[model samples]
Target: MHIKPIKTEADHRAALARIDELWEAEPNTPEGDELEVLVTLVDAYEETHFPIDVPDPIEAIRFRMEQQGLEDKDLVAFLGQRSRVTEVMNRKRGLSITMIRKLHEGLKIPLECLVKEYQLVK
Candidate 1:
């Protein structure tokens, strides 16, 4: 099991091929141990090379709402009146801490996504 820091496109491709080969390795065995280490290295490399930022809070909320077949009115239970939901969704207002907590609890939106700073407009 030879693994190294994935520093370029070639290294990344090689690591991915190795990962595919190790995909079905059984746990607690020599091959499995190598697979685990390879996976960790791959994750670290991807985190550095292919970082993904969290989406804006309102976008996250709207996405979850769409996924759950919810609408603006449905958010009233968590975000208060329909107008407030509209304002929040339109990015005219920031999420209050209480609102953030409620949205997190009610919608299962991650706090990390919720807490990201975003412009009120655009």
Candidate 2:
């Protein structure tokens, strides 16, 4: 098993192919070790070259709502009222600390995502 730093897209592709071939390798063996190293290297390269930015706070909330089949009314428990939910979702108002905490706990949205700064609709 041979491996090198994945620099170019071609190198990335080659690493992926190798990983596929070694995917069935049993653990505690040379092939398994090579597969683990290749997977880690591929992940690192992708993160550096194609970093994904965190979702906007409002968008994150909307995404979670969709995932959980929730509506604006459901958000009242986490937010306050229907109007407040609309305002927050529309970016007409910002999330307060209390709202953030509730959303994090109720919706299982990460605090890091909730605290991210986003431009209110202007």
Candidate 3:
């Protein structure tokens, strides 16, 4: 096995190809051991080089609303009255714990994404 740290795009590509070849390698075998090491190296390289930023909290809420075919009225059940929903959506009001929990549970939005503090326009 000739494994190395994936330092460059070329190295990442090579590691990916090797991983594909070793996809079916049996565990505890030589090829399997190499596969595990290569996978770790590839993951590390991707985490550093291709990191994905979390979506904006309001954007995430809007996206989930669209995906679920939800309307303002639907949000009233989660957030409060229609006006409050509008306030929250428009960044005029902050999300309460109850609203956050509802969004997290009913919309399947990640709690971390929902809990992030966003700027409220004055």
Per-model TM values vs. the true structure: 0.89, 0.93, 0.76
Worst 10 residues of 1 by lDDT: 1-10
- Model 3 misplaced stretches (Cα beyond 4 Å): 20-37
**Global lDDT scores for all candidate models:** 0.89, 0.94, 0.90
Q: Once superposed on the true structure, which residue ranges of model 1 sit more than 4 Å away at CA? A: none
Best by TM-score: 2
Please provide, for model 3 over 1-122, each residue's C-alpha lDDT reduced to its tens digit, 9 standing for 90 to 100.
99988889999999999999999999999999999999998988888989987776788999998998988788888899999999999998989999999989988899889988899877
lDDT of 3 at 23: 100
Lowest summed-lDDT stretch of 10 residues in model 2? 81-90
- Error (Å) of candidate 2 at residue 119 is 1.9
TM-score of 3: 0.76
